[model samples]
Target chain A: MATKKFMFLNRKAPYGTVYALESLEVVLIGAAFEQDVSLAFIGDGVYQIAKNQNTDGIGMKNFSPTYKALGDYEVTKLYVEKESLEARGLTLDDLMDLTWEDEDDDYAEKPSIRLVSAAELAAVFDEQDVVLSF
Target chain B: MKYSIMVNEGPYTHQASDTALHFCKAALEAGHEIFRVFFYHDGVNNGTRFTVPPQDDRNIQQEWSKLASAHDIDLVVCIAAAQRRGIMDADEAKRQGIDGNNIAPGFRISGLGQLIEGGIIADRQLVFGD
Candidate 1:
């Protein structure tokens, strides 16, 4: 099977609708297929991986932990737009420290999340064979 | 080139469906193969036959049905989204003890795997949404 580069473009905020959750579901499934999967966080999507997300007030399940588990699924290429984070008044410290262990290098743990500017992220889009936005 | 379209919104409510339809038509005219058109989120509503639009307006459901029949394209409605919105085929309707099924012709309810398969099979997987 030919492996294709699948990029999930998340621009929606969590809990407004089912888009964020459903988009994550697809990502998890796609991870199992062992494809070259990357997730881009843009606009309100930056809030999805933000730290200390408390959904108790809204009575919704907090799925922020799943973002951390992406490493286990071998989905480590997480690109966060710098403009999006700054626009939302957030920094790298505001989000979870997502990382994956590099098995090739004796299981050395490495950071998974990479912050990129809007232009850089747009270039990432150009490299994708499949771009599924939510 | 092989193409796969993902519609993230429903008809009338958003222009995503309309845009996807136009893209599909143009792609077909250009002699491209559409692996599938996967309907997700509110897009699953496009498969429901219960929508009665105004006579003067173009019926989106019929348009999709006709296009699918004309091109033999796979019009798949995500089963998870469909079940949540009560859009089911005959078998699903019977299994759920529903009185009737509203799944339009040329559309089948399937798992999210179909969408992944489309991404894998198609040269480009285009997403049309808000």
Candidate 2:
């Protein structure tokens, strides 16, 4: 089968509901399917990958670490909307430093998180075969 | 073109279901093939036959059932989401010791794999949600 471009759009915050977690679950599964998968963190969805997400008091499982595992799943394209991060008074440094190894370059590490403008991301959406939002 | 639709919200509570229904109608009218309509999250409520809207209002559940029957479209309600929201098929209801199943005609309870399969097979996969 031809590989399709699949984008998982996340617009909700973590711990509020099951959207973020379930969205991640789908991404992990989509990885096994070996499609050209990309994850977009828009709006409060950026909070999902924010650093130091301590859920001890909230009594919820902290699945933030799973985002770091995206590299292993070959889901390397993680787009963080520039406007969304700025609107929330956050910088790229606040989020996890996710990376993937480039086998073509002798296993050289490459940054997976791409800080993109809204317009640029809109263009990216146009190039996708499937946009699964959560 | 083959199109797949995913509804993430329930009827009457959100406009997602309504938008998806209208979109499906438009797609069908345009001579497009509807590969599947996968209801997830609260969208599973759209497959339940127990929804009784006021006579003066639109019956969303009935509308979907009629559309599915007329077009011979596959209306799949995600089994995991349906189970979480108390929407079950006859077999599931019996297995879980529930009183009865509320799955509507022309609708079936299935897994998330159906959603993934739809995305793979269809030319487009449109998601309607909050």
Once superposed on the true structure, which residue ranges of model 2 sit more than 4 Å away at CA?
A103-109, B94-99
The positional error of residue A95 in candidate 1, measured at the CA in angstroms, is 0.2
Model 1 lDDT, full chain set: 0.93
Second chain of candidate 2: TM-score?
0.98
Cα-based RMSD of candidate 1: 1.5
| lDDT tens digits, residue span A1-134, model 2 | 66889999999998878889878877887888888999999999999999999999988899999999999889999999999999999998999889999999998899999999999999999999889999
Tens digits of per-residue lDDT for model 2, B1-130? 8999999999999999999999999988999999999998889999999999999999999999999999999999988888889998999999999999999999999988788889999988999998
**Count of clashing residue pairs in every prediction:** 0, 0
i-RMS for every candidate (Å) is 1.0, 1.3
Please provide, for model 1 over A29-93, each residue's C-alpha lDDT reduced to its tens digit, 9 standing for 90 to 100: 89888889999999999988888989998988999899889999999999999999999899999
For B18-67, candidate 1 gives per-residue lDDT tens digits of: 99999999999999999999999999999988889999998999899999
Candidate No. with top TM-score? 1
